[model samples]
Target: MKKVVSLLALVMLLNGCDDGNLTQEDINFEDIPTQSCSINNIIYKLKDEESLLLEIPETSFTNEPSTVGEPTLLDINSANRVVYRFYNGTVSATNICETIPPATPIVTDQWSAIAGKIQIFTTAVKTTNATDNSTKITGYNHNIVFKNITFAKNNGTQVYETFPFGDYVTTANALPFLFDQTVEQCSASKQIYNYNSSEALLLDIDPSLIVNSATPLNTPRTGLIGTTVNKLTYRLFSGLLTSGYFCTGTIPSTPTVSEEWVATSGVSNVSGIIEVTTTTLGTGFKHVIVLKNVTMKKGTNDFKLGDSFIYGELLTTN
Candidate 1:
């Protein structure tokens, strides 16, 4: 049965409606306005409203350094400006601090005068240190499963496939990509969807989405590049965005022009057919955060790899 399913998938890949050549629009990255927001001097931009997937060629590593004694002040110098990274197999946070300084540290739940959070040393969670400390490995080595990715309709927004992205090989092989849907949010100005389905996790772009190893241009958009939220790893089972045209719909009669993002992967040479004249446009990317250890309120095949995740991945800059 699974083979039949795989064969069906293969058929879908070969026989799926393939059209629309995406035209490569020359976008000036510098032209996009950069907004800065930071906690503990760890700066991050909400990715401009027009900026779809801002390719972060250098932004990488969100170090939750747990090394001994105060978790060692990770320098926010390198990563403070960008967000996102890519290193499969064992997707890690920022390696701002290349080596663990001497010994491992502990946590107090009291990170500074704040009595609620404590800092710790390098463990399975944090190994490097440089930028900020968010989740001690928010999501890693996870099996991305989407049980109720409710699509709009047969012709309405529909989800084709939802699976896991094993891990980044880090070699020269093309990173398996799912040009599917954005599960998270990049900014408040992003396309707000008034869906009939429930939102388990709000969508937003991953700040630490960019990280470079051999690939000079790190595709940091978690919506495309891939990342974790809290723990579980989420990725496109297929491509990320739909190539179909936008159909007009309305919520409370307000009227919304909606479209679908079909998940298709493994194509670097694919071209666009539509001609976009906008100066600033989003480079359609998906931002998803795989959560952990929660109960599935949905149903069977509702949750995979056990624990439930409450996070979001949005179409943003990579």
Candidate 2:
């Protein structure tokens, strides 16, 4: 009887080992597969209705044109020419053009134009890991490239300017076992630009301009002020101009004579002032108040504001 009981116990122990109970070391991590994915060479055209239409003549990936969303205006130049960029649903538009034409006009006839090809480049890695009785999958290392084929614009011709689209990476999460996923999808605009550094002033603005003032303003005037800082300068026009009018002229030199200017300083006060200068002769009005020359003092360093501008009117009680 004792020998029989020992034999039964030995049989139970052998059965437990054969029941497929696995230790961590017994799991196969090498069975997991990693895939590299990419998309390339999408084309687009401007529609007559001012909508940017996708044109994918050929592609390396299985993604269709539907995966690419609409193009949004990225920037506008002094000539009224505009730049546009496209991205996958992951990225959002930072800027939009206000005036969209209703008809299909030639690239030259339209206010917005693209001089070169816009392209989006992206890459990602998908990783799979096997867990206890289940599998864990993750996608990571996503990157984006949004830029124009050329940054140099044609002389006297307004063209779209493309910059590096902002970068984004997706979060890693557990996916269903055996499920394939697209880690990233980026759309390239068909439009292009020949943008160079000199044309960067078109995007400059005065930091002090109040965009949400109760009295609204037109777009500010911006231009390459000088090479001292190799940056743009912004001059705000106090009132709205007629449609299609932009402040496009020579930037005046800083005044040598200082007036009885009231000095208002803040602990954070830099040395910039929003001065309203009156011009005796102007385009539609005899007396015009122009916002001129923004300078900021940071500690011992004085700096000029750049990269944007504003134009608007102020309401005051007489």
Candidate 3:
């Protein structure tokens, strides 16, 4: 009776090893870097004789950060698929990426993800300047994860509670900001601006900053960038910024402001200091505005304008 039971146990163990088409039980490509095809939607990771492929919309990975507790969810379906393929021999990116796959590395086993949700948790990746400790957003990292995924093969299906798909990064949009050194002041409001076509640097100056009095040659009049008084702003517009845009009594609704960054509130002479050197220019006074160690900030990201930055010159006829 003991010999018969031992033979039955050995048979059960051998049957368990034949798990349908799943010879490689562990589908681990965690350390491998994800590669994308020319089609853009297809992303895959290749290991020796195995490959894991994902076909999802490129828009799935948004450049913006995902909200905490609420990750971006995408359902696994016909259009969005996850596939694991085992080949007869070693495979390269050409096997999966090319329109016509090579015939040599033929697929031996295949598992298709039948049901699940692809969860993406995204965060902004920033680069900080060593000189001033200012930060700029370089890219965004999208962390991919699979939840309650079920993979179906020829014989049966295998369910996974959770699976990590690793991180995919996308570069941030570049800020095209270039100035021509020419400054214009608003006749209706206490504002001065230096602008290109779509980018503008504006300063809502204090009344005392641009007085007609001539300042000393070396010692210029200094002030702080405050919330209400000496406010400094950098604006990126969607449309062309005409000369009449700021001169209007009310801020125009057209040529909408896409992005805005404000100067960090000053700490006396340390940062955000507005220095104006007033020199007599014919009948009027030329007030050359220079920003000293100014740091511009938008949310958690910030960048400095170096040690000294010229904010252009403003003229007063008083």
Candidate 4:
């Protein structure tokens, strides 16, 4: 029997058959577009008030040749200057017995005593992004300023005018630093020992942004003269400055600084891009390896890579 359908029922049936609506499952998250942005060129200068005081141990000097049971007394004089080699964690005297003219005069009541202080100022330039700015490696130029240093003699005298009294500069490759806003994290690696090791820098970043880009450079192709291809490489170790922890937001009271460095592997040339992956990194920090400029060679042809000028921001989350 034909019956009049209720208005409400008719409406419901029509709505159920409609194909214009989309379900949550039907949405492709991968297809969603992300905003492309770039960080402004920011210069991060180490605060002027901040300084690192490297302490030299009195017991650092030990007698050489056939096990002297006790530590040897370092001679304090103008001719016997204490030479120090500063690494990530420790500082040692470079000249054990060889006595050269002291960079500065050493005066002390005791044979063994604290040597002096090295005042260093470090500054870095963060470069901009090229691709999706949400996740990218930024370029950096690190500058270290060494102030006129003095050594403290145990006898209350000071040795004025030591070594490293100028500015030292090093340039980084395309994205030596990474800022990931999605996770509210930032990370970078500095080559502390050119030809030796790297130091990891970790920090917190703003959580609202995302970036996906790479540091780009160009290299010459061996077979093709004057033909250069874009190649991207990381930074190399310059040298260790001082020990400190890196973080965003509030600085931790007990920031741990680790000197452990793991070498990078699996660097290959894919098309024109150089792909690098690091396996060893400190906990809570993304590790990066310092890479040298790449030179491509096939048979007799070879070329060096070049880079695009880009800059970015390096705000401390803390």
Candidate 5:
């Protein structure tokens, strides 16, 4: 509800396959806890981590302080810093950039989510002032570390706060990831408890609009995906989800296309939607258009009879 686009950024994509480099691996907490210490900055608890903070505390945290190595390709650097340990039993670390300098007054800031000794930590050190004939200024960095620190976690009294609906949508995890096929939950008996609910989506493009309309392409395949294309004007976006991929053909500009999926019986991908069967054409994939919240653009273009377009099904129409 509160404008999240500014803070929780969205990854902008150009029209094409959104295939990111994927290497299947187990989710590891070995790389979970990391910290950033900037002078005069209040560390706000990311809403998702609030619960975990209350569960663990100031003194309850174990300290196996160590030096953090530089993170590869990570925007945040952890070089020459102190590490803070916060885990069920393991220790996590963060680097300390610099500390408050002599003759400078240290300022304190606060933040929180936990009720007990959970605390907000920050310090401000005066920046270096240097200038040369070529440049006008020299800058300074802050140093952040407490003397023999501890994060004690404990609570007998309970507390709760209700955030506005739009302010924070409760996401169990980070974000909605791309379609995946891994089965969650398991047991030693190998009963295959998870029925495999993942599905691969395929989209059809009109031959006329494709760059290779006359190139004699292959038959309709079952593994097509719906990528977003903003160049054309079908204007079918509802909130944030754009379900259909755009078309770009050298010839058949206006093509009639349909979706295909397998009707997964309560245990598969088709179980939640209206799927007819489990083959390429009718295995059970149907066209779906998800509309979040709509607003009109600044200008509208009026054409005669012919206009380029793509279509999707409605949430309720199914």
Candidate 6:
């Protein structure tokens, strides 16, 4: 009777070890780089024959950086789903992209994320100008993480305290600034402007800066960019601007401003200084506008105008 009992216990242990469905396999692809499908919403990571996919909403990865202490939180549901797939053969992006899938790699085991919180922490990737000590946002990085997540398998479930999905990077839009050295001043609004069809660079001048008198060769008139006083603004419009667009009594509504960047305020001679060098033209006074160490900011990102940036010449007939 003792021998029979020992034999039965040994057989049960052997049976449990042979059963493949009884235990969960370790699923980790943290070292691999994250990849994306042609579809904007799908992001995945692949390691050998296993793939971890995330079907998230486009809004979750915004172009703008997240607030100081706040991150974008999303719930795992039908719309924002996470899936883990195991394949018989090695897998590549061709297996999951929207384009025609391959025939060989077949999915053998699958796990679906049931309940979880997706957290996206966004920050700007910046490059600094060595000459001006100014920074420009070249791209944004979205770090995706899962918190209190449960992934359900066929027979059991796996829970993770925190799963890092890795970073997704997006490039920033290039500024459309194509000025051809010609500058125009608004007679009614007292605003100097240089514009293409879709974008405009405007400066709200302090009236005293554009006087008809000639400024000394080396000593140019300088003023700091400010809010209500000597302000500089750059705007991108939705539609092409009409001629004399800024001189109107009431700003037009058709070609609305799509984006705007303002010059950063600074001390008198340090940063964001507007230098105006006036010389005597044929009867009129020619004022050459140059921006010195000026930084243009929109939200958390900023770009410098360099140590000495010539902003075109303005002619005033006295």
Best candidate, TM-score-wise?
A: 6
RMSD of 1: 32.2
lDDT of each: 0.24, 0.26, 0.84, 0.27, 0.21, 0.84
Give per-residue CA lDDT, model 2, range 93-165, as digits (tens): 1112213423323233122244444343333333322221211213332222233422232332322233332
Winner of 1 and 2 under TM-score: 2
Task: Give per-residue lDDT, candidate 2, residue 19.
Answer: 33
Off by over 4 Å in 5: 1-40, 44-245, 248-270, 276-318
**Model 1 error, position 235 (Å):** 23
| Model 4 stretches with alpha carbons more than 4 Å out | 1-114, 129-164, 176-318
lDDT of 6 at 250: 83
Better of 4 and 5 by TM-score: 4
For model 6, residues 35-108, the per-residue Cα lDDT tens digits are: 88766589999988989999987767777788877889899999999998999999989899856688869999
Please state the error at residue 191 of candidate 6 in Å.
0.7
- The CA lDDT at 170 in model 1 is 13
lDDT of 4 by residue, 1-318 (tens): 224557777888998776443332332122222111122111111112211222223123111111223212333334323322222222112111224523322321222113433333333333333342222223222221222333443334333333332332333233233322221122432212111133333211112121232223332111111132222222323454233323334533442322222212213442222222222223322212222333333222222332311112222211
Candidate 1: deviation at residue 198, Å?
A: 4.7
Global local distance difference test of model 2: 0.26
Sort the candidates on TM-score, descending order. 6, 3, 2, 4, 1, 5
Q: Tell me the spans in candidate 6 whose CA falls farther than 4 Å from its real position.
A: 1-26, 128-136
lDDT of 3 by residue, 77-153 (tens): 99899998999999998898778878878999899999999999988887866775546778888888889989998
lDDT of 3 at 128: 66
lDDT, candidate 5, 150-225, per-residue tens: 2222322122221111110111111111433322211222111111122223222222222211112332212211
Better of 2 and 4 by lDDT: 4
Q: All candidates: CA RMSD in angstroms?
A: 32.2, 27.7, 3.8, 33.7, 27.1, 3.8
Better of 1 and 5 by lDDT: 1
What is the Cα-based TM-score of model 5? Answer: 0.15
